[model samples]
Target: MSVVVKTSAIKTVRAVTFACLAFAVAFAAAPASAQDMELKIIAPAAPGGGWDQTARSIQQVLIAEKLARNAQVINIPGAGGTVGLAQFVTGAKGDGHQLMVNGFVMMGAILRNKSPVSLSQITPIARITEETQIMVVPANSPIKNAKDLAEAVKKDVAKVTFAGGSAGGVDHIMAALFVGAVGADASKVNYVAFSGGGESLAAILGGKVTAGISGVSEYEGQIKAGKLRAIGVTSPKRLPGVDVPTFKEQGIDLVLTNWRSVFAPPGLNDAQKKALGDVVAKMVKTNGWKEVLKAKGWDDAYLAGDDFAKFLTAEQARVTAVMKTVGLVK
Candidate 1:
């Protein structure tokens, strides 16, 4: 009877071991480790804006893929994302699980806002997506294409009041670049700044500005409704679904791809940066991430880890030069 009881106990232990092995195999094949805990993603802008969308996307994917048990987006919009940058630089030190969504706009924002804490203080995780900038005019206006706008801008740089967001944001930079490309003084190009896309849209629709510069995605609704006519897209080639020609195709030697990126707080060691970057790189390769990019009309421009850090340094210098030349930064 003792031998039989011992044999029964061994059989039960073997059975439990087999079950545990099977579960481990299944979990490994799953999206991500189901053991990860909560994560925090900060969107340094108002809700429903581009930064908000990116943070929320990170939140959604992390939770849905079981990469994290929970994730949240904290909005702190002001001063064109510099307000949040300042706080993050001082507060998020040594935080391994925190991230902030920032990009080309922030490059300009930092210079314009004159933030005490610059982007150089943070750690770059990855560059996720990029979009072509587009120039548009009110539907009722006479400017039809890139050539027309170029001629007008060349004739009187200050006469064509280009409207965009923030004094040094991508919109402002693109307008200045366009004017410079057309043989005009970029410093003399008149650019009026709005606090948000909604305000810029209102001004454009109300004919309060001569032309508008922004991402193609932001103006899709108005462009579809026949309220704004796209003059040119600042891409080497025309983007899919956008009927406008590229600035290059219009005989304008200009191309600019505004990219968005993810950055972590300072004080992370090399290992921590690699771990954080690896997760985001893996996330971008997922099907759910591809679907998110498709829905947002953003092109995948993924560059992770060291490569992204190098890119950030180069971009900072390039934009600084351009901004100085355009007189947006002294």
Candidate 2:
């Protein structure tokens, strides 16, 4: 009886040890999920721009939702996002934890500046938000409407300076288009390129430039406060709740919307890509992200995976064509 009892006790001890060993092996073999990894998002524009806003919003949602162990934003502003794009492509290859925010501005900057690193070098993650553009002058300025500004440009393209985001960006492109629409020289637009919305806003408010152009949300506050006067908005019709008049209604024949998106670094394998995409997909569906959209007045333009890739390709072509038409590029 004593020998049988001892043999059973030994078998029980062996079973416990095997279970613990199996648990350790399984835990060690499992890959770290996105929620367990720290994330770094690069805003390729200066602080107070649309890209910066988008990055911060994403960082907030990621941390709030516990979608990441931690998240942070790094700003690398210059050359219309080319400086940041170059660094991201070279430094963060194969890193699923790293991402960069960019959009239509970068497309024009790439062609105009002849950037060595292109968007094709990065992994397309998703297109997130879009917003219309606004053209404004200081509240005290004599330019009362789109027609007045068009007349000024027609009178002297060199004398009328327009301040906006980086050269060849959507702001610059819109200025050129507006000039062209008014029978002025598109190539001769006296545009002053700023690296950020803050700088451009200051120029407009200080009356340092004749006018300014930027995303509508960037200028909404001042427009409402009577600091800046919005002459026209590049929308087909007036925005639902906003009273800003459309360029079409004013007879200038212009409509353009700026889109913001996130891209991962190059060299990600299928698994890494899928994991990052999953994180972004989850973030977009959250109530926090929806609130961000509501506050910023950004449209929920979420398109993920291969669909985003295809959309990006088509966008490049469309932007290039528009740039050429406006004489921004050859």
Candidate 3:
């Protein structure tokens, strides 16, 4: 009986050893881990908006500088940015390999949609660039400067209808700020929302709307062509090669610069985060990035890691307050 038991135990041990070997072989035979990873640049708006432009700019620079051998810019636009953000939180969470390019609209969309995702859900990788808001009117319109536009609105609120890309988008918020500066009843002021900046530009130039608010970068070409008149820019300082004046200089006491930056999904390991941040820092140092910013009329304001995290928190609060004051939120 003892001999029989020993033989049975030996047979059991051999079976377990063979199973382990087979499992190891199968795992080893599996496809090699992907060396080229997908980094997603989620633009929260349709193509041609500032967010989309920023994504494309980053992609071009990253590839040109070899900061990323394999990368892609995906347009996940909707719900004034909430739809794309939902994907960012639920689908891209903890995906250190993916990156999203966003700006102040991220906050606007969250507040407007009451989204579950916030800045805290992602890793604030680095601030890429900042652009000023430019107030524009149709080329054929008589409105020419900030003072003329403000006086026209104050004289008759309905005389100038402001158009924006979305109800709570950066452009809309800038229009609100202008209304407040001019002491107009924001609710009473005529404001229209389009699907995107390109649409809003068309409405203004086609004479469907009296005025439009969008990033200076988006309307740079039209402004240069003399097809659109820039009444005021939201930057604190005048931009280079652009004759447009700042709202502050016009005594409007308003400055609302929009920024674009990169964010990775949350919970990256230290080594992985460092590697990603290093790549971003190298990209920022490149002349390619500088030239792109110059072309887009973006001012340099690069912040990474903890600094960016802090900035996001403050901006979140600031936007919430603005929205509340505008009666868009409680």
**Per-model C-alpha RMSD:** 8.2, 6.4, 5.1
lDDT per prediction? 0.85, 0.88, 0.79
Better of 2 and 3 by lDDT: 2
Model 2, TM vs. native: 0.80
Best by TM-score: 1
**RMSD in Å for candidate 3, one decimal?**
5.1
Candidate 3 wrongly placed segments (more than 4 Å): 1-38, 44-48, 139-142
> Across residues 173-210, which tens digit of lDDT does each residue of candidate 1 receive?
88878888889998887999887788989999999999
Task: Assess the local accuracy of residue 319 in candidate 1 as a C-alpha lDDT between 0 and 100.
Answer: 83
TM-score, one value per model? 0.86, 0.80, 0.81
TM-score of decoy 3: 0.81
* lDDT (Cα) of model 3: 0.79
lDDT of 2 at 183: 87
Count clashing residue pairs in model 2. Answer: 0
How well does candidate 3 score on lDDT at residue 269? 65
Q: State candidate 1's TM-score.
A: 0.86
Which candidate, 2 or 3, would have the higher TM-score against the true structure?
3
Candidate 1: where is the Cα deviation over 4 Å? 1-34
lDDT of 3 by residue, 46-137 (tens): 88777888888888887787677667889987776677767887787555667788878878888988887777777778987887788988
How well is each residue in 31-134 modelled by candidate 2, as lDDT tens digits?
35867968899999888877898999999999899899898999999888999999999999877788899998899989988899999999998999889989
